[model samples]
Target: MSGEWLAEVVQTLQGLGLNYAFVLNPGERGAFIRGMGVTLQLCLLTVPCSLLAGVVLAALLTSGRPWLERPARALVEVTRNTPTLVQLYCAFLVVNMLITQRFQLHGQTNPLTPFVWVVVVVSLHKGVFHAEALRAGIEAVPRTTLEAARSLGFSRRQLLLQVELPLALRFALPSLVNNLVDLVKMTAVASAIAVGDVTYESIMIWSQRDNVLELLLLILLWFGLLTWGVSVLGRRLEAHLRMPGYGQ
Candidate 1:
C-alpha cells in the first residue's frame, strides 16, 4: 500500500510539469519563485554577514576585556537558549508592531526587504553559534604556534592574519559549512513572515492542486537535493583545505 502510494505520487509529479502547474494554477509557481528568490537572497546575504559577525564576536570572546567578553558570552547564551521561531517573530512581527505604534513609521510596518530582514535575523542568530565554533577553532591553534611566529619577528597582526586565522579556518570550515546548510534549511520559517521561499511556494501549490502529498514530496526532494549538494561541496572544500600534516 505504501509503495503504491509512493508510485502514484511520483507519477503525478512527472505529469505535473511547470506549465501544467501554471495552467492549473496549482501551487502558484510564480509566487513560489518569488518566495524562493527572497529566501535565497536572504541566505546569500546573511551567510557572509553572519560569518563576519561571528569572527568579530569570537575575537571579542577570546581576546577582549572581561566586561566585553561577559556580555558577548551572555548574548550567545541567550540566543542559544531561545527558539529561533520566537526570535523571528520578535524581530519581524512584534518589533514591527512596536516600531509602528511608538515611532509612527509611515511605510510598511516591517519596512525592510524580506531578504534584508531574514538576513539580519539569520546573521544575529547564527553569529552566536559561529562565534563559539570559531573560538574553539582559534583555541585549537597551539600557543606554541603563535609563540613560534612571534619568535620569527612576526607582528601581532601578522601572527593573527598569517598564522592563526588561516589555520583556525581549516578547523572551522566544516562546522561553518554545516551551519550554512542549516541556515538555508531554516529559511523556510521566513515564509511565516510572507518571505516567499521554496517551502512557501510548495504550500501554495499544494493548496491549488489539492495534491498535498505530491507537492510535499517535491518539497522534500528539493531540500534533500540542496542539502546533499551542500554536504558534497563541504566535503570537497574540507579536503581541499586539509592542512598537509594536520589531518594525518
Candidate 2:
C-alpha cells in the first residue's frame, strides 16, 4: 500500500517535470554538501575574526589618541559606506594583485586564494558594524565604573580590558548577534568569486538540470534554517548574560 502511494507520488512529480531525483543523485548531493561545508567554514572563521577585529578597532577608536583614532575611524567609515560585493572584488582583484606583485619582487609569487579573500573582505566589512556596536557598548558603561577602576590603581590597559570590555560585550551582544546573522548571509557573495559556496554549487547544478526553481527553494530553506539557528543561539546567549534585576 505504501509502495503504491510512493510510486504514484514519484509519477506525479515526473508528470510535473520536476527532477528532485537530480538533487538526490550522489554527485549533486556531494557538490551541495561540499558547498555547504565551505559556507559553514566561512561563517565559523569570519565570526571570531570579525569580532576580534571589531574589538581592536573599537579600542583604537576610543583610545583618545588622534593618531590611532583617525585611521581606525576612516577604515570603519569606508568599509561601512562601500557595498560588500565591491569590497570582495577589490580585495580579491586589486589588493591581492598588489600583494602578489610585491611578493613576486622578492621572487615569491603567492597569490591570495579566493577563500582567503572572501573571508577577509566579509570579515572586515562586518567588523565595521561590530566596532560601532562595541564603541557604543563601551560608552554605555557608567562613568562611575571607570572611576572605581581608576581608584583601585588599575592601569589604562587594565581599565579598558578588564573593567570596560566585559561590560561592553554584554551591552553590545544583541547587535553583535545581528551582525553575525548578516555575515552568514553575506557568505553567499563568495560565489561571485568562485569560492564554491552553496549558492555557487546550486547555480552549477541548476544550470545543468534547468531546475532553478527547485534549487532556489532549497537554497532559501537552507539559509532560513541557518539564520534561524543563529537567532535561537543569540537569544539563549542574551538570556544567559542578562544582568540580574536589570531590564526587568
Using TM-score, give the best candidate's number.
Answer: 2
In model 2, what lDDT does residue 38 have? Answer: 91
lDDT of 1 by residue, 61-114 (tens): 877489879999999999878987888888877766676676555544545655
> All candidates' TM-scores?
0.82, 0.92
Q: Rate the local accuracy (lDDT) of all candidates.
A: 0.75, 0.90
Clashing pairs in 2: none
Best by lDDT: 2
User: How many steric clashes does model 1 contain?
Assistant: 4
lDDT of 2 by residue, 160-205 (tens): 9998898998999999999999998998999999999999999999
